[model samples]
Target: MNQNVLIIGATSGIAEAVARHFAEQGARLFLVARNSEKLQAISADLVARGALEVATFVMNANETDRIPQMTDAAWKVHGTIDVALVAHGTLPDQQRTETNIAYAIAEFRTNAESVIACLAALAQRMEPQGKGVLAVIGSVAGDRGRPGNYLYGAAKAALDTYASGLRARLFKSGVHVLIIKPGFVATAMTVDLNLPARLTATPDRVACDIQLAIAKRRDVLYTPWFWYWIMLIIRWIPAAIFKRMKL
Candidate 1:
């Protein structure tokens, strides 16, 4: 309830839900997102919903060079963030991304490089504080590469690798790094997809899971809970048969 939270991609479906949860818990928030108008709307809503304080920064997630500045400003306002959520990413069209090398690289930059940049910048501050949670939003797609969205999967895989190592590195420093892997979330990003109702989860449900994971200082979270077993099964399938099957 007393957490000072800093969320990058704050206006995102999951991030916004997390912010509202934080607000309900009486936490002060520093939100960063590319959309100023959307950010303002969410911030105002959070304030009205009982956020102890609300601050914002407008930044396109692709602008990796400005990440340090964003971190600096967030820490300036919040002093020490109890939780920092990196939640910005895009789910690009697999066919289009696969065909266009330049487009593929751009999508990769958005989903992977920018996140790596944030991890580098945020760690310097969190390490010194010797406390808090560095929570990154990864995906179930990262567990393994599939024909459907391998490009997006690769980006998430990179994030998982980076976070896995960083979790160990920061463990001794008293800062917990949490990696959240959500599967088929009902967000704007996945709105057009033909997601199965039985498997899909709402942003609010994910937000609850994330905060709970952070509180417990868990290393990783497979939201909706069942993704853990689902991914486990998928990861175990022999590559020979796995490659032939459609995901």
Candidate 2:
């Protein structure tokens, strides 16, 4: 079956990879992103990659007010979205955000509030349809807050909770809500960050994990699989020791 797939933040590295994977399966795509040029570029690439149909929308995802309208527009274009992925976020400078309260709140709004808004919009439409996949690209940083990137971690943590709640509510309705937690992904977004290359994953690798998760209708997934045990150890640490150690 050629599915109708809607991808928010479709221009992002991981989202683009996912789009390509879906396109290879001959899925019809409705891609939304903030950059017009990038959105169009991705659309063309997906078409070339064998997407049955590829449509593009340009909108700033962080503008929470516009997400509902955007989701509605995407649904109208596709008739019904068989799958939806929300994959837009920023990795804020932890020290800068910690000192600047306003900046911190803005980051939160972008990473957390906007995602919740998008999910809610998609959920509302999918509930009536009775079947669909709603997935979001979250981070394992959210599993536990650390001094290095607590701001980003906290936002993702909120999203993780939100996805859990949505999954429970949508389960009976047959709308599967999936949360994908990636550890360290080596994308443009993380190019400058100091990270272990061995521990990081490529967009294509993460995309494969997403495909499996969607196919299996999983509720929560930690990409690379090893992150599950890594996070387990981190979460298992005693609060006193965890607090004193640098992450």
Candidate 3:
């Protein structure tokens, strides 16, 4: 596992867990996130924890224009990115988004548009290399929209579809594109949701699953395994009855 790795949103709870897993494997890492101090701190921590070497960049991922530059920097430092994970996103307030159109648009951009931008930049680089794992943290909510969080679900759905298409496009190039659909995770982003403990996975657990999926070159991953069944049931429900019942 001492491969060259790049993690956009290196400071995210899920991203950090993945970084730690790679670091333990003595991987070389290039990290990107908005916070300069946090980026440096995580880089130091990962290096201390056995990462062969760590490089970092500070950029707000929402700035799509900066994505190409960021991707170039990662590739320059690592030479070949054996694995790259795009994991930045915001969990916006559903209630507020219902009324505030501007906020809703911004949230969608944060979760969907920015991810597309990063994917485009990374795909161009990986396609030429002819081998690498390109993974993104999608969500089970994307399987279907629910009244509680359709806005967020829609954004993840976009990523899932985009990744699916990209996966096919890169297949001939020997590149593997993986979309990670995580259920409830006990991360800083979801502390207030009070997700069921039985359903919620720890970031470490998700990271571990991700590591295996990448090794296996799986197309889509449902972490904890059970979420695949859960979302399947939800997706199969007929519109009439499903719309009447609360999710």
Candidate 4:
């Protein structure tokens, strides 16, 4: 069956991989991104790879006022959206954010506020239809605040909490909300960070995990699976020890 899928932040590595995965499965795609050039390229690529239809939109997601309008337009393309993925975020410099309130707020707006705005718009549409999958990419870092990137971690943590509450609210409406917690994904987001190869997954690999989670209607997902236990251990550590340890 051909399904209508909307991908916000569609130009990101994981989102692009997800688009290709869905295209192979014969989905109609509505892709949104801040970069018009990248959005057009992705749309063209999906069309060539066998997507049923591909629509592209360019907008900065941080402009909360624009989200509802953009989301509605995207959904209008296929009449209904079977799946929507919110995959945009930033990895801010920890020291910069710590000292600069402006930088901190900017990162927060991108990582958390913008995501919530998009989700709220999608939920308004999906809840009425009684069925749809809303998935967002968070991170394992959200589970705990490490000194390394606590600002980014806090933003993701906020997203995780919001998604949890949203999932419960949408349950009665039959809309499934999925929160994806990825440990170390080797996308451009993590290009400069020194993460272990064994622990880091490629965007394609994480994309496959996301597809599976959506299909299963999983509430919260740790991509690569083992991150579930890793987070469990981290979350259980005593605060004193956790604070002192170099993450």
Give all TM-scores, in the order shown: 0.98, 0.98, 0.98, 0.98
Quick one: best lDDT, which candidate?
3
lDDT of 1 by residue, 107-130 (tens): 999999999888878898899999
After superposition on all C-alphas, the RMSD of every candidate to the true structure, in Å, is 0.7, 0.8, 0.8, 0.8
Residue range with the least summed lDDT across 10 consecutive positions in model 4 = 68-77
Report clash pairs, candidate 2. Answer: none
* TM-score, prediction 2: 0.98
Candidate 3 lDDT (Cα, 0 to 1): 0.94
Per-residue lDDT of 243 in model 1 = 92
Clashes of each: 0, 0, 0, 0
Expressed as tens digits, the lDDT of each residue in 6-65 for candidate 3 is 999889999999999999999999999999999999999999999999999889989888
Tell me the tens digit of each residue's lDDT in model 2 across 48-92: 999999988888988778877887788878898999999999989
- Model 1: weakest 10-residue lDDT segment is 60-69
Residue 160 C-alpha lDDT in model 4:
95
- The CA lDDT at 23 in model 3 is 95
